[model samples]
Every structure is written in C-alpha cells, then in structure tokens.
Target: MLAYILRRCFYAIFVLYGVATIVFFISRLTGDPVSIMLPPEATVEQVEQLRRALGLDKPLIEQYGIFLANLAQLNLGDSLRYGEPALRLIGERLPATMQLAGTALVLSLLISVPAGIISALKRGTLSESGITVFVLIGQSIPVFWLGIVLIMLFAVHWTIFPTGGIGTWQHLVLPAVALAFNMIALVTRLLRSSLIEQMGSDYVRTARAKGLLPRSVVGKHAVRNSLLPVITVVGLEIGSLLGGSVVTETVFAWPGVGQLLIQAINYRDFPLVQAIIILLAGVFVIVNLIVDVLYAVLDPRIQYK
Candidate 1:
C-alpha cells in the first residue's frame, strides 16, 4: 500500500505540472497586466519599466522556467491586484470555502443515503416515486437560480436568513443548500441503483437462504457492499463542491475562495488564478488517490497493485 501510494504521488506531480503549465499560458492570453496596471497617461518607458519589473518583459519560455523554479520553492508570488502572496490570499479564504463545501457534502449524505436506501427497499411504492421526482427536480435546477430563489423566498419574503456574507450559522444555510442540491440528486440516484443491484446478487440470495432477517440482509450486507460506488462519488464530489460553491457563493454574496476567484479573474490576476486552479487540481488528484485506497478498505478483494 505504501508503495502504491508513493507511485500515485509521483504521478500526481506530473499532473499538477501539466495543470500549472496550461494555466500559465492561458492566463497570459488575457493580455498583459502592464497595460492594465499602469495608467493610460503613463509614458512608454514607464510601461516597459513596469513590465520588466514584473518580469512580464521576459520571453514566454524564460517566464515559464522562472515560474517552475519559483513553484519548486513553493512561491506562488504576490497578486497584482491585492499585492499579497497568492497562496496567502487563498489561505485566508480557504476556511470559508471549506466550511461551505463541507456543510454541503454532509447535508447531501445525510439526506441522500436514507432516501436512496428507502427508494431501493420500497421499489415501486409511492415513497420511491416521490423520491424519484425530488431527484429529478434537484438535478434539473441550476445552483445559482436555486440560490437566488432561496434568497428571495427565505431572506426576502420570510426574513428567515440573511441574503449573504458570513457572520453566523444563518449565513451558511442558503449557500449550503444550493450547493448540496445537485449532489443530493446525483448520490441518491447512484446509491439507489447500486443498492438495487446488490440486492439481486447471489450473496444476497445466500444470506436469505441462510435465514437472515430481511432487514439484516439488506442493511448489513447489501448496504455495505453497495457503499463502494457511493464512496467514489462522495470523494470526487469534494472538488465538485468547491467548484459549485463558485455559483452559490456569488448569488448569496458569500465571502469564500470562490468569490475571490471571480474577482481575480476580472482583474486578470495571473499568479492568483494559476495558484487557485493548480491547487484545486492537486486536490482532485489527492481525493481520487484516497478513493482508490479506500476501495481496498471497503472490499478486501480490491488489492492495491
């Protein structure tokens, strides 16, 4: 397992490098920061001087080499807009984004797990049909639209929660629900299908023939086996939660990394944007690695090679 993990980490380095390289070129294409930073009335020499100072004057290859060398030292550089270290800016906002994403993930699991199980167990019942309709609507609605509707209904009409910003628990509700909505639908559908498939397996018949109770057979054996796919979804969705938080945070005016990301893009802050995207890509890689290792934990037959 240790060897397998090390191998995955080795591969992850290449993945992050590729992400960094792609972001570097793409960010440059938005036009030079020198043009935006210096005033229009500034002389040509001032423009060249500022460009040289920022190292934007260097050739693309040289700049890339410098970037890679700086990245090796864990230096993400300072943001052009905020003049703060890119990583530091992200760090300050990291907790808020994580809080929002984590809450959404928990809410989805809390709701979806039970809903999926019941839908599978009840099969063609009204309960199953109702849940099916809920899932359909959950998946259909846009997160931003849901967030706006939530704000209008709960915050505007009922005055139940604040429209946006972080201060108390009330601030979290609207954004969290919006972020969790699609995930709840996705996980519910996946788990329901998996559970249904597990119930029809040979082992399930054996458990029934051995005189196990229906509840025990379904809850203990079938549910446990069905969890592998659910685990995969849950793991992958962490990154999705962060990405979706972009929309949710915007609509709700949440002070999270997603909001900061939008601001950075508007200003064409290359270093900050690159840092956020590459770090997010790294997160996805790490979560996927964890999921692969968890497969062995969930099912002993899944040995790491």
Candidate 2:
C-alpha cells in the first residue's frame, strides 16, 4: 500500500507539471501583460520598464525556472491587480468556494443515494420511470440558468432567501441547489445502474438462497459491491465542482475563487491567473489521490504493490 501510494504521488507530480506547463504557455499567449496594464498612449520606455518589472524581458525558460523555484518555496508571486501575494488573495477567496462546493456535494449525496436505491429496487415500476425523467430534466438544465431562476423564484418573487453575497447561511441556498442538481441526477443514474446490475449477480442469488433478508441481500451484498464505480464518479465530480465553480459562483456573485478568476482574466493579471490554475490543478490531483487510496479501504481485494 505504501509503495502504491508513493507511485500515485509520483504520478501526481507529473500531472501537476503538465498542468503548469500548459497554464504557463497559455497565460503568455494572452498577449503582453504590460500592454494591457499600461494606458493606450503609454510610451515605449514605459512599456519597457513594465516588462522589466514583470521579468517579461527575460527568456521564457529563465522565467519558467524562476516561477518553478518560487512555487517550490511556496511563493505564488504577487498579484498585479491587488498588490498582494497571489496565494494570500486566493486563500481569502477559498473558504467561500469550499463552503459552496461542500454543501452542494453533501446535498447531492443526500438526494441521490436514496432515490437511486428506490429506483433500482423498483426497476420496472413508475418509480423507476419517474426517476429517469427527473434525471433527464435535472441534467439537461444549465447550472447558471437554474441559479438565476432560483434566485428569481425564491429570492425575488417569494423573498425566502437572499439574492446574493456570501455572508450568511441564507446566501447559500440557491447556489448550492443549482450546483447539486446535475450532480444528483448523474449520481442517481449511475447508482441505479450499478445497483440493478449487482442485484442480478450470482452472489446476490446465493445470499437470498442462504436465507438472507431482502434488505441485507441488497444493502450488504449488492450495494457494497456495486459502489466502486459510483465512488469513482462521485469523487471526480466533487473535485470538478471544487475547481469548476466559476460559472455558478459568478452567476450568484458568491465572492469566491471563481469571481476572482474572472477578474484576473479580464485584467490580464498573469500572476493571479497562474496561481489559480496551479491551486486548481493541485486540488484535483490531491482529490484523485485520496480517491485512489479509498479504493483499497472500501474493498480489501484491491491490493497495492
């Protein structure tokens, strides 16, 4: 297990490096930051000074080396827009994003698990058909659109919740529901399929023949075995939710990393953009590694070299 974990960690390093390479080049391709930072009528010397200040006059390889060195030392550079450490600016925004994503994940699981079980158990019945329809509609809708509709309905028309901001619990309702809708639909559909397949397996029949209760046969024998795929999907989805909330966060004005990311992009703030990308890539790599470790924990048959 230790060896396997070490291998995974090594792979994660390669993945993060790939991300850094892509982000570094893509950020540079967005045109010169000095041009965007300076006024339209700025002189040549002014642009040269700005380039020197930002180290843009240096060779790309040299700049990349410096960036990597700083990253190794846990220094994410200073934001051009905010004049603060990129890491600190992102840190201030992370809690709101985390709160939003965490709540959405929990809500999705709470909704999907039971619905999936019931739909699978009643495979050919109206319950199953109804669940399929719900899944389709839920997955088809866009999160940003859903968030807007929710805000209009619950906050504008009914006044049940706040329309925006991140100060209190009331602000979380629309965004959380919007984020969870697709996730719940996807998870429930995957779980339903897995459970249905497991229910018909030979071991499930053996359990029933051995006088196991229906609940035990389904929950212990079938559900446990079928959860491996569901776990993988849910883990990836949660990680995605954490890093990909830019749209939802923007729509809701949630004051999270997503909003900050937009600001960085609009202003051509290379330091902030690079830091955000690195942070997102790191988060995704860590989540996937944790999921890999969980596979051995969930099923001892999954052994590591």
Tens-place lDDT digits, model 1, residues 64-178:
9999999999998889899889999999998999999999999999999999999999999999999999999999999998998999999999999999999899999989999
Residue pair clashes in candidate 2? none
Output the worst ten-in-a-row residue range by lDDT, candidate 1: 30-39
Cα-based lDDT at residue 110, candidate 2: 96
Among these predictions, the greatest lDDT belongs to 1
Return the lDDT, model 2, position 245.
81
lDDT of 2: 0.89
Write one digit per residue (lDDT tens) for candidate 2, span 74-183: 78899987889998999999999999999999999999999999999997899999999999999899888898999999999999999988888899988999999999
The CA lDDT at 193 in model 2 is 92
Each model's lDDT comes to 0.93, 0.89
Clashes of 1: 0
The C-alpha RMSD in Å for every predicted model, in order, reads: 1.0, 1.3
